[model samples]
Target: MGRTASVLLRVLGMLWTAPNTGLGLIAGSVGLPFGARVHFDPHTVALVFHRWPWGPGGAMTLGNTILHTGETLDAPCLTYAHRAGHCEEPPVRIGDHERAHVYQYMALGPLFLPLYLVCGGISVRNRFERAADRYAQTGRGWWPW
Candidate 1:
């Protein structure tokens, strides 16, 4: 794709996912008073909130916002990074997995959460989550479908 087309697609994806992103932003806002730090990542075109102080003690991706209780992973993707907890295979980098969710959210838009629940929410059986893991491991296949 040409640069213009790529840019346009990115913009379109952002627009399509705006509603969920807004919700994510609202959720992230609650973390601000608790010392959550926020930063804009131009590479992924998303907002990341680290040290969010909530959730199941890990990272969560909602649209373009990612909330995490731990620090961002910068080292090589580790064997224990996958959320499914199956260590026989390689692990999925949390950053990559969450970023893949952002991409998935762009494609699914408001349908993301509904479909995610239908796919078993956050379990290993959830196709959305499995796809995110696939994306993290291979750099592709973020789409649940």
Candidate 2:
């Protein structure tokens, strides 16, 4: 895909996930300021630093933190601290996966949430999650699933 289209998808992702994005921004500004450093990539998605020690601990939480609302948050931003004493994978790989989720947001818009819930299962069975995994492995500029 062209850069313009990629950017447009990201913008649409932001708008589609606005409610969660707003909560993430608010959380970052309020409680997360000292807890984590926020990083916004060229894709315009926000990544928050979340040390595993301070909050909940899990491998799933290591990348895009899935909230109670069932939203896998990669848009807007949230800190993702590596587990203490464990070396997480390089940011490039993680970013690729997360970026794919951002694209999913763009494609599904408001429908993403409910659909994600209905399709809830292991990543392998979930079409959205599978597409994201594919994107991470393949790189950018492909059609959104």
Candidate 3:
């Protein structure tokens, strides 16, 4: 998409997921000056609350991890980098999945939140999640497997 459309979609995504995104922003702001680090990229923004050594022990203290929020694919994301685990995929991969979620937020608008909550338990097969996974893996194609 063109720059304008992309920007519009991102704004819409933020509005669509306002509650969570707003909270994320607040949390990020509170944490930023307190040893937290925020990283920005073309497709994602990540907020790292702590840079503990990567290992099992570090993961324990970094409980309660939160992922991305907002309508834009490159929205602010909260995560514990140390707990990303054995996937070995770059952290951006998680952001790619979240970008797909931004698209979902754009498509569903306000309805997305309630629907997401209702489907949270079965997210593995949820249409929204499946679409997001597809977008992350392939960048475009979608299938509801």
Candidate 4:
């Protein structure tokens, strides 16, 4: 798992840094229910979403952060493609919003990972995905709607 995480981070970093290539998602154990594909063009970044079994709120928050910061955030499930067309300035995402799978593990590890393995894991992922998705649609990050 450690090696896989390391490799995933490296790959995500590469994808995030590369411009115009679009996001190539690599699903992991802790990935979202239905991932989304993002394409960053010259002016705006277009997101093609695969709606998760859960609702939409987490993805919206996270995506809005990337949009607000003008940063490129890439994870196994969710990713942000840059509109700048340049790799010099890469987006900086931290904590739960940094990567998809990592955040899932972090979310479920404490209380839920021990209980129902599948649902617990998916719940963590779905939450974040919802946030990012909402963020995309509303242009508001995690702020009370």
Candidate 1 local lDDT, 23-104, one digit each (tens) = 8899999999998999987756689888898877767778888887877744234433243466566655678878888999
Between candidates 2 and 3, the lDDT winner: 2
**Model 2 RMSD in angstroms:** 8.2
Count of clashing pairs, candidate 1: 0
User: Using lDDT as the measure, which candidate wins?
Assistant: 1
Which digits, one per residue and each the tens of the lDDT, describe model 4 over residues 29-55? Answer: 113434432343221222223332234
Error of 3 at 138 (Å): 0.9
Put down candidate 2 lDDT per residue, 1-145, tens digits, no spaces.
9999977866776677776555455554453445444544454255544432233432121112222211223322221222222334333354455666655655565666677768864334566655654565567542434
TM-score, candidate number 1: 0.89
Give lDDT per model, in order. 0.80, 0.47, 0.46, 0.32
Clash pairs detected, candidate 1: none
Q: Which ranges in model 4 have alpha carbons more than 4 Å from their true place?
A: 1-12, 15-119, 142-145
lDDT of 2 at 23: 49
Per-model TM-score, in order, reads 0.89, 0.57, 0.52, 0.20
